[model samples]
Target chain A: MSNNNALAARVRGTVHVIGAGLLGASVGLGLRERGVDVTLEDQSPTTVALAADYGAGRLRTAQDPEPALVVVATPPDVTADVIERALTTYPNAVVTDVASVKLAPYLELLRRGLDLKNYVGSHPMAGRERGGAIMARADLFVARPWVICRDHETPAEALALVEDVALDLGATPLEMTPEEHDRSVGLVSHLPQVVSSLLAARLIPASEQAVGLAGAGLRDTTRIASSDPELWVQILGANRAPVVELLDAFGKDLASFADALRDPEQTGAKRRIADLLSSGNRGVARIPGKHGSSERFTSIMVLIDDTPGQLGRLLTELGELGINMEDLRLEHSPGAQIGFAEIAVLPEVAERAVTDLVERGWRTL
Target chain B: MSNNNALAARVRGTVHVIGAGLLGASVGLGLRERGVDVTLEDQSPTTVALAADYGAGRLRTAQDPEPALVVVATPPDVTADVIERALTTYPNAVVTDVASVKLAPYLELLRRGLDLKNYVGSHPMAGRERGGAIMARADLFVARPWVICRDHETPAEALALVEDVALDLGATPLEMTPEEHDRSVGLVSHLPQVVSSLLAARLIPASEQAVGLAGAGLRDTTRIASSDPELWVQILGANRAPVVELLDAFGKDLASFADALRDPEQTGAKRRIADLLSSGNRGVARIPGKHGSSERFTSIMVLIDDTPGQLGRLLTELGELGINMEDLRLEHSPGAQIGFAEIAVLPEVAERAVTDLVERGWRTL
Candidate 1:
């Protein structure tokens, strides 16, 4: 452990985590790994016990002392209520919640006339498609953005405590107001979820032959539609306004595109279509690559048979060639004995890599 | 070359390909590998010369006899005109165009009062994000769907020639009418492209922080939106009717979903949202998995430090354990020194695999 990660020494006493779900258990597990005294709880005794059994934390008891900090990691629907209760129950404890949406819970607490001085609403922009204690890992939060929402009335110590915890869990601390966090997630997370789900839903009515014509494009666009719907409902409802606005804007773009295509004979109609498509290129360009940079890499596809050692051998050969693969994707066609390993490398090396591979009796595309 | 692949013997004479783009060059290379005499042409002399130098095919000579088969592999916008020219130039030849959208080009030929008895429309459902001769590979169409459009007036010999070419290139030929082919691709390919593009375009105006919050979901959904916009514009415009209808229907779904979430407390509103999401689940399940089977696999995430030999070691260990990975996806957190390798294995071996991995000092999440 790094010296900077001695967060356990900073906290005066125990850290109690309410709700032993994925985020809560992950927080507990990460903090406990850093030698923090962590206690876990949940509405269901089984969940808390299961989280404890997984080395997330020990279960709280009547004999235990009051916690110095309380983390409420519950489902979004009950986040406000839980945070309200946590602040009241742990009078001196700094309380924070890891709900995906920020504005709703903060506004809810304000509406309830709760003094929010001790509470710092935060969201750790980290999760797996599947959730629960069983899926929790100590490194889940590592390097992910942990957005802390603090008002002017919020105590410096409380914000520092939350930031320290975020850092201790190996997360990058980002400060954003509740509204900013909600809108940001509304664009990035919630909007994409709805679009993906709706795109996949269209396939429900399509013919089997039509669906069978599905390629990598359709598969990619609908991949996230497989996420849990119950969790999404709560999230979407929490961040309704921003997501709705985004949907409206996106719907207009779709409609306008359809109009442009509907009458290509109109002057500039074709250009409009090209413009919309190009806009997509520009928009996707903004997304950071794996290294958090927008710089692109050239992909070289190498064909391999569907055998155990083929990919390993190819990668081993690539290593021998002194080619640093920036990214790797394996694509297998339906009912094919062949697979394609699409390796992304710096553009400058792509030509040489392809030539070398082809010369070495490997087929590349 | 396999003796059974007597493509040279079957062709009787040269096969001419009119576009030195990815698909056309790939077809040329695959056929060339099978010992078929192939002639290449393109709008750009340099493109054709480069494709020839790459061994895709040789340049046609003035004294060369008429091609036995002429494949019109032009851009989507000019596919029909090129197909007509190919048919007129080689009257006895079996003419085929490998354009993406079938019905549009087919209809255009009919409207021009040209006899298309020798012409067959086909689409090899294969491409890379980046196109051109440089990106071409011989195995591009291997096991990929190559749709052939045939009508009652179509001769058996002409259809057989096209099917043979598809087979010779290791593609699976599926016969469908022009209308059916257009509609199928409209749903499976065109609709998803539009949706993905629109979703991605929404990100163009988003804050940098919002884009930073993008995860695998956004990445997956927008993956194909990075495709060549110029090529897509021609495709979307050609298949305008069916795609418009799809977008309209999808728009209604999005509108209803937004409305449901907007007033989720209303009777059956929440149920409506849940039903839509569940439909997406069922729809995605209908997509054939790798190797044409819908067999699901259990994925286990293993955490590893981002270092050389870590992934190779994991795969090597997996081989030692006699575990066949169905699929593998690597995810790295931004600025983190650790990564997660999500390995998909058959459900039966998942439990044992996890246990054995943990015992071997590997962290399985």
Candidate 2:
């Protein structure tokens, strides 16, 4: 590995990581780990020091010279401005950014007359609910999709450099236009956040007893609502137009659903409920499977006794059959005699596992 | 514990669990575990057998006599009918029900001319995504709230028996009216499910490239969308009125938000985003603190390098501080220098932990 490092000797020029927040610091740390000479700069002295202490990069003082690559990992509001600054500050370097929403920044860069030849716009679709340089992770990008938005004006060399960085971090690089990226994320990312926040907002006035009764469903839906308000303010604000359009469409569907529920006729109500429920079914079908594409799995229902070792025993039996379980659900009735355990497994092995359990005096349903 | 078992024997009697599914079976198993004589009956013979095989209770044939307490653990659609049947078939037993939605079944019981004196409507707010008797757990009700809805006509003996059953299962018992319970759940439970399903539905048509970019946030928000459609149809249908009302309110708020975002004025757009984001702030505040009531906790931002042992080391340090982390977040930024680790802890310990980390070689922000 050291010989491989020697073969890929550091380019004489330094790599400048702008903003020095979570994304910026992560990029610096990841590149430094790969034997790149990285210099970090941030608007906040405290953030710069924090990133430096974590070995993200050496702190770049104001007098530091130009670099080969400049990664701008600032907020959406300032990504374009920082990118433009990097382009001017290091005329020989390639400039890139890690921002959630891409179109606006890309447009702003073009309007500002920065050399689009040296710039590439990208978004690494990975993040936690937290923020700042303190949470930088070298492997945060691994196995995640890193979207690169390339326009007709984007230079091939610059795009390749960005893709190389993405691959180095163990991410899959996907190419999309800025417009497509925005609209796509509007449905998959921003819209969900807005919807989650809206639902969570409803609980603000809920009674203590009501809130206490909250179960996993509510927890899962509102998990993103616990995100940093200030950061979301910027993200949603920047992507407001696309998100609003999606929410508007969603509101129409919700209205239709509400009206159907309010109808006195049972047929229409049941039909509407089924339709809405079926929509969810189709949506679940579209989500990528464990390894990145959708594939159907067989579901098996087993009767499990309410005992400590019962579940362990069931899992052990299935494991012995070498049946890889995809998903498992344990349903509990409040005062029922028994519960049903629904397990999802490979279709080929599901029947064998079921037959095995049944043969062992275990009830299979 | 053996002495406790002797004390429990003093109160043992024939416990009739009406529904033989997961909750009902679990109740039977719990009671049976405590040496209580449990007689389980279900509308369907298959379910009854499954519950019996899972040890919910000994299947009670038609010739069996009525038990002391009857637990109606059927689905909401048939809960009232089952309650009525149990009352008519075993007139001597004190009857209670375990339904997710309470008001409709309770009202239906009233309409069917059942003896309200012998019946107490109860809901144990616990369940898995799947259903059936095979998944029952003897401790499913442990430490969770078992709500008993009572009216002026309800017999004190019936309420006492229900409370006894709940206590025997180590559940906390709370009292409420059917109306209050329904509305409370509308805000905290049903509405969130609809919202999650609706959001998940939006992802059906998302581009494969975009879907590939999905992170943990999308996963969390849509986790509940995978719930059984047939069961949700019954749940949403039974509680249609309250759920529709809440959805209508949410739609209105969402519409207002959409209009705000579409406004051409920058200031107005930003103000709207701020409103939506701030709503989340208040919403998160209303959620109960981890394992307790609603209380604010301090969130510490820790800088984490994307390395194998980095997270483990941070957790170890926190454990050494005797600080129990309430929540955690990992923010992933593509092509960034570092990831952010947001750790939620008790407010009193936040400052000390931050200082301790800073004093050690770690950065705290």
RMSD of 1: 1.8
TM, every model: 0.97, 0.84
Question: What are the per-model C-alpha RMSD values against the true structure?
Answer: 1.8, 6.0
Per-model lDDT = 0.85, 0.76
Model 2 residue B273 CA deviation (Å) reads 2.4
Which residue runs does candidate 2 get wrong by more than 4 Å?
A: A2-12, A59-65, A264-267, A295-365, B1-12, B264-269, B295-365
Candidate 1 chain B minimal-lDDT segment of 10 residues:
B1-10
lDDT of 2 by residue, A79-146 (tens): 88888888887888888888888888887777877678888888887655346777787766766688
- Scored by Cα lDDT, where does model 1 land? 0.85
Deviation of model 2 at A190, angstroms:
0.7
lDDT of 1 by residue, A1-365 (tens): 66434686788789999999899999999988888999999999999999999999999999988899999998999999999998898888999999899999999899999999999998887857347898899889987879999999999999999999998888889999999898888888888888888888878777767776778788778888888988888888899888888888888888888888888888998998898888889888888777777778899888888776666667767767778676777787678788787888889999999988898888887
Return the TM-score for chain B, candidate 2. 0.85
Output DockQ, candidate 2: 0.29
Winning model by lDDT: 1
How displaced is residue A210 in candidate 1, in Å?
1.7
